[model samples]
Target: MPAALADGVVTRIPTSRKVVALTFDGGAGSQGAASILSTLRSQGVPASFFVTGEFATANPALVRQMAAVGPVGNHTWDHPHLTSLSDTAVRTELSRAESAVRAATGRTPRPFFRFPFGEYSTRTLALVHASGYGAVGWTTDSLGWKGTSGGQSVDSVVARVLAGRTPGQVVLMHVGANPDDGTTLDAAALPRVIAGYRAAGYGFTTLDALR
Candidate 1:
């Protein structure tokens, strides 16, 4: 299959197989990391993780644990909007994040990266590629990071993900809590989402497949 690239970023896995890629972004507090990991393990599912340099540095053990199970991608140094920074700054962000993840897991986060906040530009894309990484974007955003106060619930999160069900679908979730409410809606809704997808006859995959 030809890899799907939208503006030089992978928005889906680009396969004809009935599979979905589950991915989590780690930029802040990892209130949901443990639950997400446990659920994935219990279900024997493969998922991807994108972590900021700060997050990786602060949660080395958890990062290593994630790396043990699935591929870990870079999410930049301070979760900055790459388009807002110069080429040099963008490269630095990628380098710093890569260094942090390597230090934590003894593995390079090469060939896989996700834009912080999903923000990027044409120039930024070239910068990312030159830095030896491919940017990944989601086909379906769970929106669980919005929390209850933001009018998102566990059930809603499940529904949203299932609503976008498709072959090679990439589902976006966050491993951190909603800053305003401290709710981990994605983690809370994960088991049901997995079950729902299984019932719908979809298998799980990780970004590593892109390699």
Candidate 2:
């Protein structure tokens, strides 16, 4: 992410296998939630969702389903930029998100967190760690949230994914849509992407497993 992490923010796993972790960010409502979940379930791929407190509270069914399958990570209370908040404010945000996920899924969120906007300061990192989570960063982002995840084109998303993929990498994709465009690229492209990875002899794993 920033060249190096003086604190313990993990961008990729330290391994040399063809194993990749696909993580989804669901900080808002359930826009493409069904498609993403169905594809992941039908394809038997594992993922970790970093859901905000607002998201979990708004979509309890989706949150429960996610928790039933794999790990969920805290994404803060309302997708606030943690760098702008005080240390107490940051802890409160994380705590609220953790509590929300726990309330929805009957399990505490995994001790992992993702900062809103991928913006974090040294103080933010220290605060998250103190709150009992290893900050989750990404090696390559799918950019699916920008415009249908990339540019209102499924092919573009796949192309970007194939071009940037590497062993032991953490791929970031989102499960919501842009309000203006109503585009969600990753779901439609997921099966093809999965097929592509399988064809190339790559295997899938969850971030929790990777860590």
Q: Please name the candidate that would achieve the greatest TM-score relative to the true structure.
A: 1
Clash counts per candidate, in order, are: 0, 3
Summarize candidate 2's per-residue lDDT along 117-172 as a digit string, tens digits: 98998898988877878788898887777774335588888888877778878888
Model 2 stretches with alpha carbons more than 4 Å out: 1-6, 148-152
lDDT of 1 by residue, 1-211 (tens): 2243324778888789999999999998899999999999999998899999999999999999899779999999999878889888998999999999999999998878899888888899988887778889999999999999999999999999999999999999999999999999999999999999999999998887787
Per-candidate TM-score against the hidden true structure:
0.96, 0.93
The TM-score that candidate 2 achieves is 0.93
lDDT of prediction 2? 0.82
Tell me the spans in candidate 1 whose CA falls farther than 4 Å from its real position: 1-7
| lDDT by candidate, in order shown | 0.91, 0.82
Global Cα lDDT for candidate 1: 0.91
